[model samples]
Target chain A: MTDWQAFFIALLQGATELFPVSSLGHAVVVPALLHWAFRQADPSFVPFLTLLHLGTATALVILYWRDWLGIVKGFVRGAVRGRIEAENERLAMLLLAGTIPGGLIGFLLERPLKALFATPRVAALFLILNGAILLTAEALRRRSERRDLSREEQEQQFKSAQQITFKAAFVTGGAQALALLPGISRSGVTICGGLLAGLRHQEAARFSFLLATPIIAAAGLLEVPQLFSQRGPLALYAAAAVVAGLAAYISARFLIRYFRAGRLDPYGWYCAAFGLLALILLR
Target chain B: METRGNPALAGVVAALGALFVIISALYAFGAVSFATSDPGAAHHYKHALVALAIAVACLVAANVVRPKAA
Candidate 1:
């Protein structure tokens, strides 16, 4: 691929990765639609994609540095003392629970699923289904009393990520599991699961962002060595990674604010329309 | 100003998605090509007619599902 193509892919990776839309779906469909030849079977493809994800994960870490600091401190202190801090223990465990399903599923089924639905046509179909998932989730009447909260109150409730039950995390993680599909989005499913579990949108969004960091890191770490072994342009890829990071960071900021009072319905429309176009044109 | 924010912004996004569909269609049908080295390069997209129709329906559904301001 050309430098500009790599840059464009990185930009899309950064933005869509966080936007509760399927970045994987975009990764598949966009190239096919543009008639850009990307060999998914090529050994280098996953590494290239992982580098872009590293950029995304970096953005998440930077954005939530304070939260990460607390989670780490609390985790380390508890590990040494054998008595986890009440809030940190709960939050950390919930994140662990939320990570489990996707991790297991990716480990076992990723190869098979990619073999079956990695094609742009199949990914596009799943993308439309993803739209339906977002809309249906949004349409469910919120059960939490936190509905109609102002921005500041919402922030307070966000701290209640500590209060998330293990069941909630498991279910949300189950949603993340579906993201092994090319068009299924990890953040979209987790956030939808979060909302259904009675967390407000911002809360769900925050947790989704948190949930993404480890998964992205693990995937990137596995493939980054391959990137160096390959003949790809290091400077161009680095520039693309930076572009991806910036795009993800900005998109996350916008989304955090938007979810304050905004609905996921617009994204639903977006996914449906784009997926339709994909289904029509792509094989 | 209708699209500076909020409900208007939502519609604008939907519209832009539709525009992309249109552009994609143009590319698929050889109405346009970005093959700079060979401008006349022809690209074939599967099911061009069906794609065109879906592109139109996408625009409709996008607007139909748009949330009203307020």
Candidate 2:
């Protein structure tokens, strides 16, 4: 792959990786639309892309080091004391539960999903459908309430991670499995699932990010072996990966703050516009 | 809490918005082409390097400038 291709793909990886829109969908669709020479089976291209994902996963870990550190510290302390701390122990268990569904689903279907990744047009169609999912989710959140509480009151209800239940986490995990398809946004779907479970927007977004940590790491671990089989200039790929990681980290920081204070409507609108554009252009 | 506007914070936000725009434009335009011709290759690589350099410079500047909180 050329340096330019690496840079663009890295940028795409960084931006869409955080945005509710699907990054994988963009990765698959953009190259196909442009008729780029790198095929899905190209050894150099696959390794190069895998390294970019590693960069993104690294960025997520660095960006959320505090959360991950808390889980680890909590687990170790609980083990030493032979009693679980409620907050820390609950968090650790929640993460474990959230990861199980996707891990199982992905392992069983990895080969078939790999085949789906090669179909850009199908991914594009799914991207549009993913937008519809987000839109419907937002509407559903607007309609439901615990009782007769007002909209603002309802929004204030689930402000923290403590409010999320074990059932909600499992549902979010199942939603994450949809990410196996290219156009489905892992973060978007999980956050939507959280909203459907009656969690507030910021709370949903936070849970989505926390939940994404392990999954992204697992994806990198699976791809690392394949990356080692390639014969490209490893240094250049490493440099690009570092650049992508830093970009992703900065993007994640901005997004967390944005989701906290901003409404999801803008992201919804963006997905709609992009999905429509993809349909038109790809057609 | 005090609600005064901070010029440095404003600058940081403005800088971030600009960075977002540049990156979005690059993706929208397919400016990182990897076509197999010499000119196409040069165009693609040059754009990538420029974007990487700009992104890194902006990040460093954001860190060093210590934008005062509003």
Candidate 3:
């Protein structure tokens, strides 16, 4: 791919990666819709995509440095004392619990699911379905008299990561696994799970991002090694990765803050509009 | 102007809008092609990269250039 092509994909990767609208869905559909000659089986494609994800994962890490730092401190302090700090222990456990369902399902179905990546029509249809899901989530949030509570009030309603039970994480993780489908968004589904579990939007968003970091990193770790095996100059890929990473970091920061203070209606509307347009144009 | 609470959110939306506008304009004026074909792949990739750079830069700038406190 040309440098310009790489850049656009990087930008798309960065922007869609964070948005509630599925980035993978767009990546799959956009190329196909544009009649790009990208072969899903191309040796370079998966690694290139992995690099893009690495960029995004790195961005998330940087953007949420404070949160991660706290988690690490909590973990280390708890470990040294031969006892887990209640908060840190719970946070770590929640993350692990959230990771499991998606990890197992993704591993078992990786090959079969990836084949679907080539078909943009399916992705488009799924995008429409995702739109429906988001609208449903908005409806649920609205109907529930869950007044926009203050942060402190919100805290009282939900337990911290450490306090979250295994059952809750498992459910959220199961929801996350659905993101394996191209248009089903990881954040959207997981956040929906969080909200349904009675966590406020902002809290759910925070957990979703935190949960995403490890999963995304694991995906990058698995795929990035392939780039090495193929034996290309790493510099260009590194530059692309860095560009993608920076974009992702900024995007993540924007999204976390956005979901915190804003209503979900705008995103729901956007998804509905985009999904409708895709169906009309593609079909 | 009430500039508290969701300024970051507004900035992101505005930035995304600008990107859509530029991309749409390029496609409309024959400056860029959105069709799916061999040449289109090259065009799409190149245009997408430029768009990505512009979008990323705009977002970063938004984060860095804070609005004056209301």
Candidate 4:
């Protein structure tokens, strides 16, 4: 890939990966829509993307280092004491439960999914579906809010990730697994799942980001050797990764604050419009 | 307050952990293959890490579920 292409792809990876938009979809479809020549099927592509994912994961880890530290301590403490009594321990276990479905599904079916639907056209179509999914989730959440629960009743709902049940986490993980599809967004679906599970937008976004770290890191960790292998331009790739990491860190910071009072409506509309535009242009 | 814990379930989870670690070893040794694309030594090592992580998680989970009072 050309240096500019690599840089642009890295920027796209960083920002969209955190945004409710599908980064993979953009990575796949944008090139085709713009008539960029690099083939997604090129042997070096997956490893390059994996490296970018690693960069984004690193950004997330840095952003949530305090939470991760607490989670690790709690996990160890829970294991030794044979009880998940603390909030940190519970959050750790919740993340474990939340990671399982996506990890397993990605491990087992990622290749097949890519083989079947990796085409830019298909990704574009799924992007529209992703938009619909996001809008529907917001509508449902609004409907639920209209129920007019008393202050005490609203206070009883899950306010933080730690307060959620394991079952909720498992189902949210299932939502994450849906991102295996080319155009689906991991953060989008997980935030929707969290919303359904009673978390407000900010907390849902926070939990979604946390749940994403391990999966992204694992994908990168598994392929680190390939990233350093002799076939690609290692120096250029490293530069792109740094770009991606910085973009992701900034995006995560922005999204955290935005979701505190913002809704998914704008992103949903953008996905729908972009998907439709890509569909027409690519055709 | 004392809470109920299932030791038997913990044992089962621990067994699963052992099985995954064994599978990880097999991958590391190149004793197994998946039906998809051709993989190199790095691929095998990568999968081995995945299995090892899973095994570790399971082992920890087993401990978390084991009866503390027993």
How many residue pairs clash per model?
0, 0, 10, 0
lDDT against the true structure, each candidate: 0.73, 0.68, 0.67, 0.83
DockQ of each: 0.01, 0.01, 0.01, 0.45
Q: Per-residue lDDT for A17-121 in model 2, tens only? A: 777888888888888788887665455566676777788888888877887888778645543443334676556546655665655465446446756564777
Write down the DockQ of candidate 4.
0.45
- Tens-digit lDDT track of model 1 for A68-115: 887777655543443334676556557755765566466446666777
Docking class of 1: incorrect
On residues A1-283, what C-alpha lDDT tens digit does candidate 4 reach at each position? 7899999999999999999999988988999988898876677786778779888999999999999999889878876776887889889888887886677677668877878898999999989999999999988877766357653354245477887777789799878878878889999999989988988788899999999999999888777776667387777888888899999999999999897667888989998999999999988
Best by TM-score: 4
Q: What ordering of candidates by lDDT runs from best to worst?
A: 4, 1, 2, 3
Instruction: For residues B1-70, write the lDDT of model 2, one tens digit per residue.
Output: 1123335744773486367447635633566443212334324432343344334433332332343343
Find the 10 residues in a row with the least total lDDT in model 1 chain A.
A76-85
User: Which segments of candidate 1 are over 4 A away from where they belong?
Assistant: A80-84, A142-159, B1-70
Best by DockQ: 4
Task: Let me know the DockQ for model 3.
Answer: 0.01
Tell me the interface RMSD of model 4, in angstroms.
Answer: 2.7
Q: TM-score per candidate, in order?
A: 0.75, 0.73, 0.72, 0.90
